[model samples]
Target: MNSFLSTSTARDLSLIFSGQGQQRPQLESILFEITIETSTCETAFADIQYVSWMQGEEEILITIGAIVRIDS
Candidate 1:
């Protein structure tokens, strides 16, 4: 009953992957496809540069963004 939950803020792209060894209940693995300029292909970012609008919102944002959970 475990799985993965993925979401993209820029696009309404969300899905779940569930199986035998993939039962981690996290977004640990991502096989995404992105489009840039006139070319489209699969890609992933090694690191993210996240900027917060609020002064005291760094911890909150990081915590929320790192969450990939299941409702048990």
Candidate 2:
């Protein structure tokens, strides 16, 4: 069974669209570089920036039970 996970891009939009983000470890945080490969999986996300209450946050709504690959 696959679990649902919520992820979002921060201030830099490149994080989500271009897979560009910090690789260094933080004080108390685990960072996973996620890439949305359409060829491998179905579309399971929606751009909710326009409908979100806080539009400035630039939120991307991911569907529940979406499958993703995680690398360590």
Candidate 3:
């Protein structure tokens, strides 16, 4: 994914394993730069796994799951 899509996708995924986000058993992906933007600040991440909470075959809880860059 490009930076824009990566950023948007990253924000969609707020899961941080044991962080505040709802936990899932598993979620994984490769590497890229991602940024979360808002009125006052911006955060960057890379090398993440995007995962989402899905119920049944359709309903979605959290939109995305990703690993934030350790050095970011």
Which has the greatest TM-score?
2
lDDT, candidates in the order shown: 0.30, 0.61, 0.35
Q: Tally clashes: model 2.
A: 0
Over 1-72, each residue of candidate 3 has an lDDT whose tens digit, in order, gives 333222324433433322444344574443444443445333334323335233222212222343345554
Position 34, candidate 2: lDDT: 66
RMSD of each: 14.5, 6.5, 11.5
How well does each candidate superpose onto the true structure, as a TM-score?
0.16, 0.53, 0.16
Model 2 scores a C-alpha lDDT of 0.61
Ranking by lDDT: 2, 3, 1
After superposition, candidate 2 runs with Cα above 4 Å error: 1-5, 11-28
Clash pairs detected, candidate 2? none
Candidate 1: residue 26 Cα off by (Å): 11
Using TM-score as the yardstick, the better of models 2 and 3 is 2
Top-lDDT structure, candidate number? 2
Candidate 3 weakest ten by summed lDDT: 54-63
Model 1 CA deviation exceeding 4 Å by range: 1-14, 17-22, 25-27, 31-33, 39-72
Per-residue lDDT tens digits for candidate 1, residues 31-58, read 3433222253133222121543432322
Residues 22-66 of candidate 2: C-alpha lDDT, one tens digit per residue: 465543444566677758768577777788787766766666767
